[model samples]
Target chain A: AQSVTQLDSQVPVFEEAPVELRCNYSSSVSVYLFWYVQYPNQGLQLLLKYLSGSTLVKGINGFEAEFNKSQTSFHLRKPSVHISDTAEYFCAVSPRAGAGTALIFGKGTTLSVSS
Target chain B: DTGVTQSPTHLIKTRGQQVTLRCSPISGHKSVSWYQQVLGQGPQFIFQYYEKEERGRGNFPDRFSARQFPNYSSELNVNALLLGDSALYLCASGPGNKDTEAFFGQGTRLTVV
Candidate 1:
């Protein structure tokens, strides 16, 4: 079984400020990582994913995450953020070998941006 | 193109009653998955179906049952519902390929009283 932990339950930042949402996972084998964003009353949208290869994986909306194998972390970051970026962020992990496996998600981190 | 769509955006049911939720996957998608999202918590996997066959299920009880149709539509039925079952039911559709991305629907909010 695999689980994901999001260190921050909520993050508040001013517009144009940089932000980092921390995530960690515990797995015995290789895993695929994903970051999903959920706006108010909406379904989740994929922000980025880390399947393999380069440590730094960039995603849509200027978001990026670095897969740190040693630390077991896949933290999401953005150099500068807009108010539109305010939403709930979830971290998820799926087993690499387990085909048809369901993604395990973290509780989530609420990102609130104020102008 | 249409994304995943779940019907009955909001539903209210009494304890011990039964409820059924529906989902229509995107065109060409072959895999449909169901999840429950309790307030203040992330969604939990419930079941997955591919090609109209059960493929995977999470640590849920038998009271939660689901089936997929040949057209890739799906229905999730909950028998003997409990108040604890109150949550948002989400449906997701994927290409059923290892490399394709999975898309989610807005979800059906179920309130059990």
Candidate 2:
């Protein structure tokens, strides 16, 4: 079994300000980490993922995340944010490899970027 | 270029009624997974189907059932609906079982009264 924890439920930031969304996971075996964004009344879109290779992963929209093995964390970060970046972000995890491995997601963090 | 797609964007049902939700996966994708997202909460896994077979199931009750068709499209059936069943049901598609990226649909909002 795998579980994800997102520390913040809401984050407010001004336009052009930097932001970070914290995520931690608990799993007995190797897992794949992913960050997803959901706009108002829309489905989740994959922002980034960490499988095997470098710990630091870059994603679309100038966002990035670092996977820390020791800390069990995969925090998403952006150098600067725009009002269009306001959306709900979710952290998810799944087993490394297997058939029917479903993803388990965290509660979610709502990002509100205001000008 | 089409992503995953779901039907009946919104539905309203009474308690004890039955409901069916549909999903169409992306072209060339063979895996379809179902999830439920309640208000103010993240999505919960419900079922996963691949190659017209059941691949995985979540902690949902037996009242929740689903199946995939020959075309790889799927349908989720829920019996004896309860108010607690009111939630946004999402369908995702992937190329295969171990595929890393899964595309998602807008989801079907099922409201049980």
Candidate 3:
């Protein structure tokens, strides 16, 4: 079984300032990591995913994440944030294979980017 | 192409009432999964269907059920709804059995009163 933990519940930043959302996971087997963004009253949209290869993954809206195997973490970062970036971000994980392997999500981090 | 689509953007039901939510997967996608998201929390898996068969089920009770049609559309039926059942029901679809990124619908907000 795999589980995800998002360290921060909320993060506040000024417009054009950088921000980071921390995420960690525990799994006995290989897993897939994903980041999703949810706007107010909207569904989750996949921001990015890390399957293999490059440890540094870039995503939409100028966001990026680095997968650190030694640290067992996948932290999302944005060089500069905008007010529109204010939303809820979630980190999710799923086992590599087998039956009933659904994505387990973290509690989520609320990003508040203000001007 | 249209993304995953769910019907009845909002619904209200009394306790013990039954409710059915619908979903239409993206074109060419064969997998559909259901999730329940209570306020201020991440979504919890409910069920997953592939090729018209049940592929997986989450920690939900038997009162929660779902099925996929030949066209890859799906329905989630919750029997004897309770106040705790009030949540946003999300539908996601992927192309295959592999862990590909899934597209989600806006979700149906079910309010059990």
Candidate 4:
């Protein structure tokens, strides 16, 4: 089984400032990592995913995440923020060897960006 | 080119009643998965169907059931609805592979009163 933990429940940042959302996971087997963002009253949108190869992966909306195997962490980062970036961010994992690709998600972090 | 689409953007039901939510996957996708997201919480897996077969199930009770049609569309049914059943029901679709990313729908908001 795999589980994700988002360290912060809420993160506040001013517009154009950098922000980071921390995520950690524990899994007995190798797994896939993902970051998703949800706007108000909407479903999740894939920000990025770490499948293999590059540890530093870039995603939409100028967001990126680094996969650290040694730390069992995948933290999301954005160099500059906008008010529109305020939303609920979630970290998720899925077993690479499992037949069902059900995603196990963390509680989520609310990113509130203010101008 | 259509993304995953779910029906009845919002619903209200009384306790002990039954509710059914629908989803249509992207073209050529064969797998559909259901998830429940309570307010301020991440989505929890409910079920997954591939090629009309039940591929995976979460820890939800038997009152929560789902099925996929031959065309790859799916429906999620919840019986004996409770206040806890009121949530945002999300449907995601992928190509039935581990390497691919799943696309999500707009989601159906269920309000059990």
Candidate 5:
């Protein structure tokens, strides 16, 4: 089984300030990692995913995340923030193979960007 | 390309009532998954269907059930709704493979009173 943990419940930052949302996971087997964003009254949009190759993966909206195998972590980061970036971020993991095909998500972190 | 789409953007149902949510997967996608996101919490997996067959299920009870049609559209049914069942119901789709990622829909907001 695979499980994800997002370290923060909420993060508040000013526009143009950098922000990082931490995530960790526990899994006995190799897994695929992903980050998703949910805007008000909208569905979840894919931020990025770490399936293989590069440890650092970039996504839309200038967001990125790094997969650390040893640490079992996949943390999301953005060099600067905007008010439009305010949304909820979720960290998720799914097994690399076999029958466990569902994505396991963390409790999520609410990012609030202020001007 | 059209993305995953769900029906009835918002709905309100009384306690003990039943509700059915719908979803249409993207073109050529063969898998559909259901998730429930409550206020201030992350989404919880409910079920996953691939090629009109049940492939995966989450921790949700029997009250939560889903089915996929030959066209790859799906419906989620919840029986005897409770206040706690009020949440945003999300539908996702992807190619039925081990390495592919799922695409999500706009979601249906279900409020149980």
Candidate 6:
């Protein structure tokens, strides 16, 4: 069994400010990591993923995340954010071996950016 | 290409009643997975079907069942609904390949009263 823990329930930032959302996971086997964004009343959209190589993965909208194997963490980072970036962010994990495996998601972090 | 599509964006059902939710995968996708997202929480995996076969299931009870058709479309059925079942039901599709990610639909919001 695998589980995801998102350390923050909400994050507030001013426009053009930096932000970081923390995520950690516990799985006995190898896994793939992902970050998704959800807007009000909408489904999730993929922001980025860490499948195999390159611990530092960059995503759309100038967002990036670093996969730390030792720390068992994948933290999303953005140097500057806009009001449009205000949305719910979810961290998810899937097993590497099963092509049909289901994704396990974190509780989600609400990112609120004010201008 | 059309992404995953779900039917009846919103539904309301009474206790002990049965409700079915439908999903159509992307043209080339062969796998469909179902999840339930409750308010203020993350999405929970319900079931996954690949190539018309059941591949995985989560911790949900047997009251929840699902199947995939030959065309890779799917239906999730819940029997004896409870208020706890009220949530957003999401359907996702993938190529059934180990190297790719799944695409999601807007989801069907089910309210059980």
DockQ metric for all predictions: 0.62, 0.79, 0.68, 0.69, 0.65, 0.66
By DockQ, the better pick of 1 and 4 is 4
**TM-score of candidate 5 on Cα atoms, chains taken together:** 0.97
Q: B1-113 in candidate 5: lDDT tens per residue?
A: 99999999999999999999999999998999999999888899899999898888999999999999999999999999999999999999998743257999999999999
What lDDT tens digits, residue by residue, belong to model 3 across residues A1-115? Answer: 6789999999999999999999999999988899999999999999999999999999999999999999899999999999999999999998777864487899899999988
Q: Candidates' lDDT values, in order?
A: 0.92, 0.95, 0.93, 0.94, 0.93, 0.93
| Residues B1-113 of candidate 6: C-alpha lDDT, one tens digit per residue | 78889998999999999999999989999989999999999999999898898888899999999999989999999999999999999999988743247899999999998
Model 4, span A14-88: residue lDDT tens:
999999999999999999999999999888999999999999999999999999999999999999999999999
Clashing pairs in 6: none
Among the candidates, what TM-score does chain A have in each?
0.98, 0.98, 0.97, 0.99, 0.97, 0.98
lDDT of 3 by residue, B15-104 (tens): 999999999999999999999999999999999888888888899999999999999999999999999999999999988754456889
lDDT of 1 by residue, A15-113 (tens): 999999999999987899999999988888999998879999999999999999999999999999999999999999988886576888999999999
Q: List the candidates' TM-scores in order.
A: 0.97, 0.98, 0.98, 0.98, 0.97, 0.97
Best by DockQ: 2
User: Candidate 1, overall lDDT?
Assistant: 0.92
Model 6 chain B worst lDDT window (10 residues): B94-103
Q: Which stretches of candidate 5 lie over 4 Å from their true place?
A: none
Model 2 DockQ, alpha carbons vs. true complex: 0.79
TM-score of chain A of 1: 0.98
Can you write out model 5's per-residue Cα lDDT over A1-115, one digit (the tens) per residue? 8889999999999999999999999999999999999999999999999999999999999999999999999999999999999999999998887863888899999999999
Output the better candidate (2/3) by DockQ: 2
Cα displacement (Å) at residue B68, model 6: 0.5
Q: In candidate 6, what are the lDDT values of residues A1-115, reduced to their tens digit?
A: 7899999999999999999999999999899999999998888899999998899999999999999988889999999999999999999998888546879999999999998
